[model samples]
Target: MGQVITFGEVLMRISPRGKKKFIQSNVVEFFFGGTELNVGVSIANFGGNVKHIGVVSEDFIGDTAISYINKFGVDTSSIGRSKRPLGVYFFEVGAVMRPSTISYNRSHSSFSEIKPDMVNWDEALIDGEWLHWTGITPALSQGSFDVLKEGLQKAREKGLTVSADPTYRRGLWQYGKDPKEALSELLHYSTIFIGGINEINEILGTEYSYSNEDFIRASKQLMQAFPSIEKVFDKIRTSLNSSWHKIRARMWNGKKFHETKDLDITHIVDRVGTGDAFAAGLIYGLRRFDDCKAMEFGSAACALKHTYEGDVNLTTVSEVTTILEGDISGRLNR
Candidate 1:
């Protein structure tokens, strides 16, 4: 088993319970979420030797984040704590006919201000074998983008396997320049690429498409463009309305391809970190089983994430094993 390392910001997610806006909020729940840190936590929960690499504010909020992370047995020594303020996300959950919304207060996030030297690129993943990153990181600022490139170069030199999923938060990107150039640089460095086609199209410079075959072909072009990359994966969605969606995914594993039927993800509590959950599952399978069996296992884990309530997935290894053994009926487990 190899160690896993992830780099990105960690935010305190404050979300309203039922159907209350931020101004009209009476009840709210607090859960920590940042795509990269969430992925690190999930990997740690599965007993992976995981270390979250990023900068955190030296304030009370940063302390709070570290406390919760410590409870999960994550290594925080490598996580830098600075004199900055922590970042947060305000979310408003919606009911059947309503739509949910999330607002990020991560403008001056500690991790966003990261410099290349903050992470000793050559030393960070010295004991690690896998590195995972999200698209959200490079969208922060020029310094962070440089830091990612520095880190990726080191990871490549160390012969580490890299996985990237550009979750595509278009709202956060338009900082200084276009997102295409930066996104492409990072994608070229990744071996396991996981993302959605619609969000990726903007970065790939393509036109509108409602065709599945077209998506696979375009995604294939990207995979072929980067010979270092072994697989290209993305989730597909058919929206019936604001709150209801039918979601499925397809994968191209260098040699063969596979796709699954869309699962009705009606009880979506937090659709934010589901993509990371899928990537985590996929990588876990790829490391454990052969190519074909791996994607099947990954797709099952993602389908299970839809039924859970938080950004962190609740599917246990035993549950995933059951699903992997050809059971998507998802009966209750008590």
Candidate 2:
């Protein structure tokens, strides 16, 4: 029985080891990443029983994925496999003022063609306290959306809390349907809903400023639009450069809206998976303590992501705690 169950694709991320780009470099490194998978992996790293549910190709890449995710302590027994090839992504980690670029080669991959009846949700979420997913799945295909809705409903009936990140990526959804339709439908069933304010505005057909008031209005509107959401967490960021960032998060938990202070992050090795890190932290907070302290852990975890170089963060619990304690002094640990 898993305590945390998540479903999402996992891709092989190929990029240069440091700041060099593809054309300007040789000797690129390999790591695996998928937002849903990242959340499950992070929970496992923090000493939780985490299960990753997704389909992978039966080829060599799929074989490698089992090994890759196993190292992070996620239970891999619940995954589905097919005789196809896994998806691949190319990344160029930005430096200075340049934005990072991602080129996905995932068309016709395992997940895009996944069937809804592939996994036994009853067994997968038997003792699950939480089930999480993202809007990205709906963008993949209608089949995947049905699979997610089924899994989440089963979790709901079993009295498990459902959480989701409306990580609306522009490139993922195909087949001529707007993301708003699918996302709105899914959000109606979620206990907690999270998203980027900018992403939501684009879908909502509105303009918003970068101030707290703007996000405050956005959360209020989204919460009213979908009443199943008891809480909304928005991770607000202000980028200074490719290597540094200022971030804070706000939460609207039914009763009131709360905001955390801005955290200055330096030496950011990667940013792709940071939002998932925030969600993991927020979920942990929801399960462990009151909303304020939970927000603290969630914010701190995002800071720790800036220090790591892969899709799954490689930092220790103590390290995250130190950051949570406001020690950005960067002292070495034993």
Total clashing pairs for each candidate: 0, 0
- Stretches of candidate 2 off by over 4 Å are 202-208
For residues 241-298, what per-residue lDDT tens digits would candidate 1 score against the true structure?
5567776778877677778766676666556677777777777777778766666666
lDDT per residue as tens, model 2, 1-334? 3488889887888998787889988899988888898887887787778889998889888989988889888888888888767878999988878889889988788887777779889888877889998987878877788889889888888988889888877778876777887777777778887776776585566687757677778777777777777777888888889888998988777677788889998778788788888888787777878998888788888878877888986655677788877788987668
- The worst-scoring run of ten residues by lDDT in candidate 1 lies at 261-270
Residue 293's C-alpha lDDT in candidate 1?
Answer: 69
- How many pairs of residues in model 1 come into backbone collision? 0
TM-score of each: 0.92, 0.95
Q: How many backbone clashes does candidate 2 have?
A: 0
Clashing pairs in 2: none
Lowest summed lDDT window (length 10), candidate 2 = 196-205
